[model samples]
Target: MIKFLVLCLIFLFLPFQAATRKQILIGEINHELKNLSALKIVVFKPTISEETEYASMVIQAFRNYFVKKLAFDLKDRENISIEVILITDKEGKGQIIEQKEDQGQGTVFFGKSKQEIKSSFFNKEGIQIYPTRSSSLKENLELPSLLEAQSDSVLFLLDFDNTIVLRDDQYRGQGEHLKPLEYKIKELLGISYPKILPEETSINIGDKAPNILLEGRKLSDYQGMILVLTFYPAAYSGIFDTSLITKRISEHHLSMMSCAMHITSFDGLSSKIGGLGVGYFAVSESTPEILANWKEVLETYHIQYINNPDYSLSKSFGSYNSNGYNKRVCVIIDKKGYDILPISIMINDYKLGKKKEIQEIVEKLMINI
Candidate 1:
């Protein structure tokens, strides 16, 4: 729950000195290993071009560095050379086997395919892998590349074909693959980082929502109100987040007919939307007190009578068909059954400027309605 922004400390560079900052940013890659343990990495060289050039780059960076430089950093220890393979469709599908256990490490691939750059830092050497051909992905493989990890084993997977990264713990990223190789490693390893775990990525509109939102709730009961869901992990302190953006929308009197108000789809139709409780190492937002607080935010925004939505992303809405979530996304579902992803923004995709784009979508919706 600690804000992951703390990782910025590592990137802050020298303050007030533009030249110093640039020097750090553009300077040569630091080859000195910073006491970080050498990792066992799998370099996924996909025979097919299913992954984007960037996704391929991420995989290669890991391979290039560990194979050449990482071992040198820990010369006293056995140099942990990376193993590589050009994963096939059948290989990606094996996450399909799905027997999940706990212990984990993450995956990294560093190198170049026709799609990726050869290398950047900590090393440029490549590890060659002999890959076995994969059989076709099966129709019943419900989950996308969902794989079980060996204790501390991190599976770095290239998608089934050439899509983006699938939503698997082992599938580190998607379309807007993390830049360079180093940062990708940071994010995947954040969970086990020495200082703090990284924040959960924002959930956006249009992407299939987590089932936790609709579990045990009945969507049939309330088929009348449109739902606006705001998602942040239980770890986020977004108490003021909904109120700020919603002030503009509230001015439009969105609650003219509903009996009550809600946000985060929180008050939409279920109490479970209150966010994970203390049991998950987070404070409970489901208590009546918290409900009152959420209601206050809704009221402040002039929203009313909208019970939390009871529809499961998969069951009620007929399956949460998420090609995959890009960045933090937010969606609007009209009660009459029009699903408008006017706010399909991926905050992580910086080039897309998704946050501003989402605001524009919201404004446009207000104008149209």
Candidate 2:
């Protein structure tokens, strides 16, 4: 059976032959990665095959962009080791193929599986050698690219606990002044603050909320079905403070009523007082330490917002444009923890309407899913 032996040898050696003039990305192989302290990496020159130069450029760009992030993630997990075998121009010519996606452009190339390594490199698409965890890795891995940082506008991010403190505490110089400061609610109305928070940010409506504490009380424990997270200057007996407090509270009640016209206020603002009632989780005043903490978190998340004690998040996200915080606005976070949906942001109305109709659109997006 000399013929049989020849066929067997060909099959065994075929992979090496097929691998020539192409890139090889060895990922998720069961072999010990920890043993690999460091390994050499290779890159294959790209050429225009049956595909467009633009499409090839994008793919090549992404591959280079993501490698660093991928390596870091893998190292952090401490489970796998990856080594780039080589990158070379394609040796043989093949039929061209192109894949497109819904919003933006997406591309796929057809050739030897070994030529290109992708997130979906090894399913039914590639040889499944050892049962691997590539799919799981794909989910957790975020490829680093300049795509996210390129957005032109400045993004002001804030965290719940640290950036703004809702409780009363003695502060050092200049810290007290920072509190009770009013935000230019008017500036927010007409100005574009991204006008949208992406689902990727993970803050939403109705999501199982973490128990937020205020004044030594867990707001999460409130039995009331509706929770309102309102911000405002603390209640003080001064004539100016008293009038502002009363007027703000009255506006909150009125807005709740309007929301009821479309839906019942019961399941609507479920009587929960913690995340609900006036001044629940609202951070009215804060200590320097507390403010810094919130600032750090905001910077980490890239949330865009200007700090103003006079303007609650409600007023800023709601009607009050550039001028200051006034009128109470509510963000109905869904059970899944995303902004429920943005409603109309109207400047024409005196009470200040939703300027971007973000609430309605966000609602539709949540509902359809």
Index of the highest-TM-score prediction: 1
Per lDDT, the best of the predicted structures is: 1
lDDT of 2 by residue, 178-286 (tens): 1122121112112212122222222233234445443444434443223334332221101111223346445763332221121121122222222222221333332
Q: After superposition, how far is residue 30 of candidate 2 from its true place, in Å?
A: 80
Q: Among all windows of ten consecutive residues in candidate 1, which has the lowest summed lDDT? A: 276-285
Residue lDDT tens for model 1, 323-349: 211122234443334332222332322
Give candidate 1's whole-model lDDT: 0.28
Q: By TM-score, how accurate is candidate 1?
A: 0.24
Q: What is the C-alpha RMSD of each candidate to the true structure, in Å?
A: 23.2, 25.0
Which regions of candidate 1 are displaced past 4 Å?
A: 1-40, 43-55, 70-79, 90-125, 133-193, 197-351, 354-369
lDDT, each prediction: 0.28, 0.27
